[model samples]
Target: MGGFRSRSESGRTGSGDKGHDKGQDNRKRQGGNRGGGRGGNKGYERRSESHRREHDNARRRIGSGDRVRDIVFEVLRKVSTDAAFANIALPAALREQKIHGRDAAFATELTYGTLRMQGLLDAVIAEAAGRPVDKIDAVVLDALRLGAYQILRTRVDDHAAVDTTVELVKANGEAKASGFTNGVLRTLTRTPAETWESRVTAKVTDPVARLALQTSHPTWIAEAFNAALGGTPDAPATELADALAADDARPVVHLAARPGQMSGEELALVTGGDEGRWSPYAVYLPEGDPGDLDPVRDGLAGVQDEGSQLIALAMLRAEVADDHGRWLDLCSGPGGKTAFLASWAMGDRATVDAVEPAAHRAKLVRTATSGLPARVHEGDGRRLAEIRGLDMPVSPEGDGFDRVLVDAPCTGLGALRRRPEARWRKTPADVAELVPLQKDLLRSALKATRPGGIVVYSTCSPHPAETRDVVRAVADQTGAVIEDATALFPDLVESGTLDSAPFVQLWPHRHGTDAMFFAMLRVTA
Candidate 1:
């Protein structure tokens, strides 16, 4: 399974703190004060105490200069010792330590930033340490990598980075190793490796290796994105590095109106983005508490990406007949797309079926589409066709579905700005492993569709293996033809030029949206 565990098995459930027993004891003590004379004051005092403890824990877990160093070390330790993923382990650690607010934000920055820049960071570390980075203890290597990131990229004080890392070493029950941590960090910070520049400037080299080391992407991914976009290999590598380096805190929230429930104008007043974009009904929200929006709070609006909305709209535009038919979201999870599809279908009197394999995510899809009239399935998309044959919710009576969306599970390289740490954690092997799974999902979605139905294969990543190659392979195998995605969604097409392939690709630097790729394939029955 490419080291990918199910969410529950991964410990992603929202447990608060893991290391401290004092918090639990305090809570129990507070419960005993429920019938006491000073109940209100005691309650306030307990809450204050809890907040202080949380803040202190945050500081200890990820201090200012040591934030990225500590987190990356922890992630690496968990990954090496427990065979954990950076994505699953890092988030769990942050939440468990009650690291929120600025401290939490800093921890996120350090962890993700170090991961994204690991290729470069490791190169620097290797040169400075005068030894291969892989030979080092995973914990010590991660700690050094974290320290390298702060010294090279961040404005954190050098002394603080060194001292705090030493503290992290000691706090981690490695008091004897604190001197080693301090020695390494100080040596590297004092004399950063000069080999990185020479490596970047060299030309006669392995393309993937060059890209991976210099651009901080797995070599295969650089090749895949380059091949998919028909661009020079160097361009995608540079772009990937830039995307990874982009600040994570600036993510924009998108708000959409519930179909026939709220107007765009109403949503605009709440979200406050430019309301005159391609999807007039959609608005981009600047950074704010989305829960503060009344419509969102009341379930009349949802927080989704504009790129995702465009994906749904592109599929809808493929074939909008007077007769409303069925729609399916093959991999609807955490249900953003499912909610949008359900709302649109409900307003148009069209039936929409959303399928998700995971129970928790499927429940989220159900909750997101609760007020809308849509069927939610807790089954895998790869098995949907066979499941339908065995009296599943999918009926054989009408057109299987007029529009089917296969938002396949991907490496998510395109959505790097949103999932800051993902770029760091993902490897070439990860993308390679996801190709077969994505191919199967797309194939299943095609088989479940009606003759004239459109199967839209979408990915948050611009990687060719996961996006273009997968779609092309499926099309060739099934004899499904590719149509012009821009022609279908003209509003989404760039205004200037139209001389190329059929799929639609949105880029962050170019489209001002998350880099998303979409291809509309018409299955010939």
Candidate 2:
């Protein structure tokens, strides 16, 4: 494992500026006041040691082994053990635990940070424990990750981080591992965050491994990001570190100003956000919960990444020689793009047929597109030929849909920043397993499109196998013409990148959007 050594293995935990003794000296010099950090900040990792100590001391005075950490650990447990999503699980947990204001913000950072840095956390933990992270008990591991995140990346004091984690593990019946947990964290505290970055990556000579260890991403993911940036796994990626770093940072929340209902400017004024760079219907929420906004609650606006809005907007902008009123959103679920599509379709005198195999998500699509000219069909888009209840529109010659969006279910590599725990959960096997399904959906989508109609193939992933390969396979098989999808996007899209590719790929590092890939195909007439 690429991480600093533990006391048990190396007989020393190493040292640096924020090491235990120096950090304690700083806290003492500040007289241990407990007012500087009541809540967390966007830059919690970089806060001064004394400032973090005051934050920890304030928590200690109010509630040690408290609700904030309890909530964070619970969310981590759910994510690691139950595969629950942090974004959804965290809000419910915060509400249930009655953690709000600064504490809620604190919990959010700790939870997302712990999950985001899991790979590095595990490596550090394995070194600190002198064993593979896989050997640690699940509950113990969760507690350790929470504590390690605070110790390595937050303003929480080293002592507070260690003690609270020990208390948490004991409270959760990991008493036997509490000592083990304590020793590991204590060993971790001996080094500062900056030093830890170097120590962990020192042994790894491979550029991908070094970036992976430093940025807390899986090696495969770092390699994928590098490859997407036009680098080979063996070569040093000029932008690989930046690409991976983008996932490590907190994501800016974006909202879609429902087409025909409200404009981006109107939504920005209501929510105190800014208009997005690309999609005219996109608004960027800098801070605060979007659910609290009236527009979001009123269905006038919904949280959607700008990349997603671009997918819908790009599909609408793609040229279809003869206009038709029928459109389809294959695999539409938790329907952000579907709503945007249907809203535009409502005014264009068109109808939309959205297919979702999952029942719960189908309901979400129905809810999202309730007032629009859209119909939600609960079935597999991969079997469009046999589906009996599809309410799709046809042309005068019984032709299929004019526009189709195969926002194909993918490995979700592009949106790792939004979904914190997703990176750790996905494996190469998952990608291999999903590729066939991606091809199936694309093939079915191409087959369902009428001659001269356009089909937009997209994924929230930049993986070659998922993005280019899937589109290439389907187009090659069907003789579908791969149109220059870059032209479909507005000129405001990131410059010096993707302007020449036949498709459009938006990166978070470049475009401040999810790594969404778009390819437009015109069916042979």
Candidate 3:
């Protein structure tokens, strides 16, 4: 990451001030192309401009010879050293490098694919290197990983994957390690991917460990899914394996149409995507970037997972005894759910008070709900029961919100497809660290909600400790009654596979959505 600074298109060319001045002088000597209209200068101008433009283009193309590899390597190195998120860092790097179309798509696939299969790749790398990967230089290891991914997963010519990887190593000033990289990747291409996978997973005696290597998930996370899904005696082993496989596959981009901003059909029609099956507001983009759409640019729609949209919609779908129309999003930073709730509340002449501790995220909430009936409060949501005044008037009763949503933060294991490096980044200890904050946020949300009102507790993880354990612990302390939350999504719960009663866990494999857990509670006096 130290060597890798994002280079702009201009910087890639290795252009100098002298070159710029010379091009300017050439332009002046040749006269203008369109305006001058001088007989001889016209031909001269066209030649001058064409030559100058080609020279500029050549400069831009200098360091960009093997662009796809360079982009992938840069992203991989950053993820390794800076601990940067690939989803966020890759796009910015691609834009800075001016990569688009098929090239951008290739770069994206290579980067995400490489990161996702790093564990499996490393196993094979160690076999090929005949030494532990830990002993290998980090830069060289990155090159080997990228090369291994191409040879194993992609259809790139085996020779090109190895040759370009060696070239990439040399480009990074690791000339001595190029021979080592070549040896490893060439050996990688010699074996079929299936053979390599079998060889890597052969010695894993633990079922969970074997599955983890096969699916490229950490052993603990795979175990967590098994426990969460197999809480009942009837759960099958294949269900957990399928869920892990789904996490490794490419995820379709889901777009949410803001209420009164756009319709799902309209979003699909505009973006050439299809309507999502689960949520009314969801539009599924099969592939490509969502930011390119007009509705997204205009704030009429946004990139949100369908499962997330379902949880937000459940707040409106919940049959509250008294609909106070005041909603509270206790942890409303980076407000995807808050925006959904706010959009629906505006139609009902209600308002939403979104509380976030971070000021920047509060600003993001404001921007997401810009012209909607949402008021963003920059304060700790744990004290949401106390904050009375927001942008709108206060309720006569204290914090009397009819519906409250606590989308408490967790390890984000459910979004592994979108966040390829998450599996390696998260640990079992992280789950322990998150539970207290998650419980506090849920408790505060319950406190701020009105009696007989609905409180939706959710997380983007399926860990039993975070989902059921936290809910049951809080219920025991607060004496809140768990509602039939599954009834809220009747269509999805038809098979009863997704219905865990009082709670709903949507799986990537089962529901084609993230493993989002939702539990609805009714506050009692």
Error of 3 at 259 (Å): 2.6
After the best TM-score superposition of candidate 2, give how far the Cα of residue 157 lies from its true spot, in angstroms: 1.5
User: How does model 2 fare in lDDT?
Assistant: 0.82
TM-score of each: 0.75, 0.85, 0.84
Cα lDDT tens digits, model 2, 349-425, are 98889999999999999999888898888889988866667854567645788999999989999999888988888
Candidate 2 residues lying further than 4 Å off, grouped into runs, are 1-64, 391-398
| Model 3 stretches with alpha carbons more than 4 Å out | 1-65, 231-236, 385-399, 495-497
Report clashes for each candidate as comma-separated counts: 2, 0, 0
Model 2, backbone clash pairs (residues 3+ apart or across chains), number: 0
lDDT for residue 4 in candidate 3, whole number 0-100:
12
For residues 1-525, write the lDDT of model 3, one tens digit per residue.
Answer: 000112112212111123334555675664655455577666876896687666555533453259777888889999999999999999999999899899998998889888888887888788766778898889888988888888778788878988988888777756546566766776666656666677678878777777777878788888898888773333436676788888777888899999766889988899999998889889999977688888888888998999999999888899976476888888898988888888888789888988888888889999999888988888888775456565322354444678889999898988888899999999999999999999998887787776778899999999999999999999889988888888887788776567578789889888788989999988887
| Colliding pairs, model 3 | none
Best by lDDT: 2
lDDT, residue 429, candidate 3: 99
lDDT of each: 0.67, 0.82, 0.80
Name the lDDT value of residue 513 in candidate 1: 67
